[model samples]
Target: MAREVLAGRMGLREAVRVGAYADALADRVGAARHEYERQSPESRAGEEAEARRYLAGLRSEIDAERAPSRR
Candidate 1:
């Protein structure tokens, strides 16, 4: 969160707001994970790998964005 603010992706006040909502966000993530786990292996086939790749791409995008601006 602090990194986001330092990277200029989020302001301090927005970070504080996100902090306040963190618990709720965590709960939702947990619920989603639980539901995903409940799915049969056949139904979930290939999804975990796809999700991992998607998340890795997002991380790369964020890292690129956080790099010092050339301009």
Candidate 2:
């Protein structure tokens, strides 16, 4: 991507900013994976269930938003 900037594809400032954001996001994902891997099996199961519930709630909210409004 830095090379893309040199090739006149994107401005240097935008490329640097985007690269920094991607790096930060990857770091966060790596940390989360590390933490999850260190958990006990039972704890991991509980975490998975909780995540599922949270995602289901989000799906419901999105569905409600997309529904047509009643008069």
Q: Number of the top candidate by lDDT?
A: 2
Candidate No. with top TM-score: 2
CA error at residue 38 for candidate 2, angstroms: 0.6
Candidate 2: count of backbone clashes, pairs at least 3 residues apart or interchain: 0
TM-score: model 2 vs. ground truth: 0.62
- Candidate 1 stretches greater than 4 Å from native: 1-18, 46-71
Q: For candidate 2, which ten residues in a row score worst on lDDT?
A: 12-21
Q: Give per-residue CA lDDT, model 2, range 1-71, as digits (tens).
A: 65777799888667657967568667889999999889999999998899999999999999999999997
